[model samples]
Target: MELSPSAHVDTFCRDRLPPFDLWPQLHFDLPELRYPERLNCAAALLDDAVARWGADRPCLLTPTDSWTYGDLLRRANQVARVLTEDFAVRPGNRVLLRGPNNPWLVAAWFGVMKAGCVAVTTMPLLRAVELAQLCEISLPAVAVCDHRYLEELQVADAPDMRIVAYGGGAPDDLAARCAAKEATFQNVDTAADDVALIGFTSGTTGRPKATLHFHRDVLANADTFSRHVLKPRPDDVFTGTPPLAFTFGLGGLVVFPLHAGAASLLLEQATPDQLADHVADHGVTVLFTAPTAYRAIMAAGKADRLAKLRRCASAGEALPAQVWEDFRTATGLRIIDGIGATEMLHVFISAADDDIRPGSTGRPVPGYRARVVDEAGEPVPDGEPGLLAVTGPTGCRYLDDPRQETYVKEGWNITGDTYVRDADGYFWYVARSDDMIVSSGYNIAGPEVEKALVVHPHVEDCAVVGVPDERRGMIVKAYVVLKPGLTGGVTTVKELQDHVKRTIAPYKYPRAIEFVADLPRTSNGKLQRAELRSRAVGAAG
Candidate 1:
């Protein structure tokens, strides 16, 4: 398919796209995977849902209100009208969206796509510094933000950008302006391969890299993982803890549900306790959350509240075997473990139901292909740990960045994760290629030790890292968060050490243990291992 001449106007994202030969091989082997050249994701996921299942079907639910498929379509149309008429948003203009997960926020996202504009959704909790960096990179012509987050957007360094605030009483508020606009809109005719969103990676290790996704990429995920792995039903109710800004949330909470004609329960802020409660109260059938959240829910003795769920998914970090086993024991549900990246849009490797293996991230999603390769990019033998390389319907396309070479090489997405494929083809995660620790003559994956420690009844949370040591060059160190009443004394440390020795290879046990009240984490609940390593080095010095 060729690019539509009328697809875009600004041309920044399109012009910056890495050359075609540099793109990872794209496959569309499945019959359902075929997409039309002229496509609009919002139209396919939202308006089409309304057409297929009536407008009155519930699509989005929250504590105080709900939006039917028809309601969301009307609101999205109004938002598109406001963008075109009030803000003068042109085709291909980048539109920055700032807000929590809400009906309005989802509507704004659809509005951007319907208008042929790029949606750069930023986390609601981000401060001016982060917002300024995004504004500098995407150069959005306008922003649709929640009233609560307007201060940060106003202070962000985007002099040419106009701001429209929603959920406020101000006369110029987006809702009020949208109210005066028509409830119907003609969506722009965009090419299937036209960039629709710029998803920025969560910069836990370094500066955030913006990943571009074509309109087809959005629907491709729903057709692949949501169809084959999740197999959600139209009556299913989905809920999760990830923010709308994260692609995981965007896929799990928005695209997957609407694609399947299911309803989603959106939450502005959800702790593990709150998430469990909502599952019980809303009769949520499908759950999407991180491993940390599952552990916290189990620790809080609230696992019983998730009895209503038929399926649970774990991602954003490696799902330790111990965590997976404990969750299944407590809830009788084997949490589906998947390995996905912001670069790839969603889970390219996952297993469902009887196919799930406790410690292994499953084979590639049907439309994708993956392999474990050595440093030279040659395929490694089974049982040998090496870099994970993947190619599929979706792959990394960084936005005008020099790091493009580092992400895409030789027609494959070189995910920085290290893995070893078993003789059966299940991929066992070793560690992040960069996070692998070499102590003495042994190579240790810190997550293996952390997993061994986390299963102990007294351990609430833990992180394992390599600490500098003159004699051994580097030694395993564990930073642990104990249960409230548990004392972080010598006895507890020895118990954890002994637990690791029994769980995996004895040589991988942490040589030193430090009890901390909490481990550093990103806003999305991913462990900041780099921060933990830095602190350990400082303490040693």
Candidate 2:
């Protein structure tokens, strides 16, 4: 399909998408999955809300202000006008959006889509060198940034890129320029399969991988997971900690709530205590955050404040059984744990309420299919650990990268996760396939050891990785963050070792344990095992 109509523009993302055959099998059998051939997701998500629901409906809320659907729609329209008329952005142009999770960021996201420009949203915490790597990959023509972040983007060394900053009162700022624009705009008519966003995965080594998603891919996620699994209502208030740059946040905090005609609170910073306080004060019904955040809320003694929440979604990392049980014991709400990847737009495997199995990542969402497979891409029998493979409407489409072959093989997206499916079809997460540690002829999932250790009273957070050992080839090493006022001495180390031995197989216990104030994590809150491995190597050397 011809997605872009403008003649004078760059088609970088579209040109770089992996061949069709390399894409995982896409299914859209559900009635709600039907989408028009030509679509602008922004119009469907924003403009349609004003038409279907009333303009007076609450859409976005911040600590200081709340915006109705009409307000967001008009602002997004003004942004589109500013981009096309003032910045010379045309259809098929690439625009980079930089900011934390806030109303302006959401407006800029819709503005890019309305103008038919592919949006590239980056984490606010990324340094210049990392930003330089992204610029080298997507080559965005224009960047809409929060004014405070302009210096870093400038230092990224993209000579040709034009930047427009907002969040400051400068006359040249995007908000200032947008003030003069009309509150109405004719959105570009983009095809369903048009590249809408390039989500960059925060990999530990080498350049980050840019995952391409079509305009349809965006709606598909909301329609599938949000519609079926979350089942959000119009009165539901959504909030989360994941940055919009992460597809997890995009789907959970933005797309899902909007699709349901619900209100969302955008926090520039949502620490665990703050998140819990917001839930109580705002009457938030649903929350989307990481497992760590959930654990923190319980640890900070703010779990009771979250009594107002009915549904709590966890992702970005595995939800340990201990954490899940502790949360349920405190809040009486079973946290919905799902496994999603940047390649697949959002959560495909998830279960809510009574369907939730504490430790297992639930069955696939209605529109998707999943399986555990061997190295040869063949199915592994139930109860056997294998690669997690999924096929659905949304799949991996790497931008100009040959790793496409490694991610999507024979119509299944290899998620790089080791999983074991029980007789009942619940998928139990083992670890990142690469994270499985082989020590002394024994296979141990690092996360399993971490899970056992995290249940200890003194442990706040921890990571387990295999370190090279002359006698055993490799030995399990754990880096732990202890609770406040708890010291990690020799006595504590032996106590944790004994605890792990008692919890699971004795051989799987950590042979070495180090104490740290915090564990390294990606901006999206996933543990950076690769960095932990490097730290272990450094300590051993």
Candidate of highest TM-score: 2
Q: What residue runs in model 1 are displaced by over 4 Å at the alpha carbon? A: 1-6
Residue pairs in clash, model 2? none
Local accuracy of candidate 2 as per-residue lDDT tens digits, 237-310: 99988999999989888899999999999888878999899989998999999999999999899999998888
Cα lDDT for residue 24, candidate 2:
76
Pairs in clash, predicted candidate 1: none
lDDT score of residue 495 within candidate 2:
97
Lowest summed lDDT window (length 10), candidate 1:
1-10
lDDT of 2: 0.90
- How far in Å is the alpha carbon of 490 misplaced in model 1? 3.1
Which regions of candidate 2 are displaced past 4 Å?
A: 1-9
> Scored by CA lDDT, what does every candidate get?
0.91, 0.90
Counted clashes in each candidate structure: 0, 0
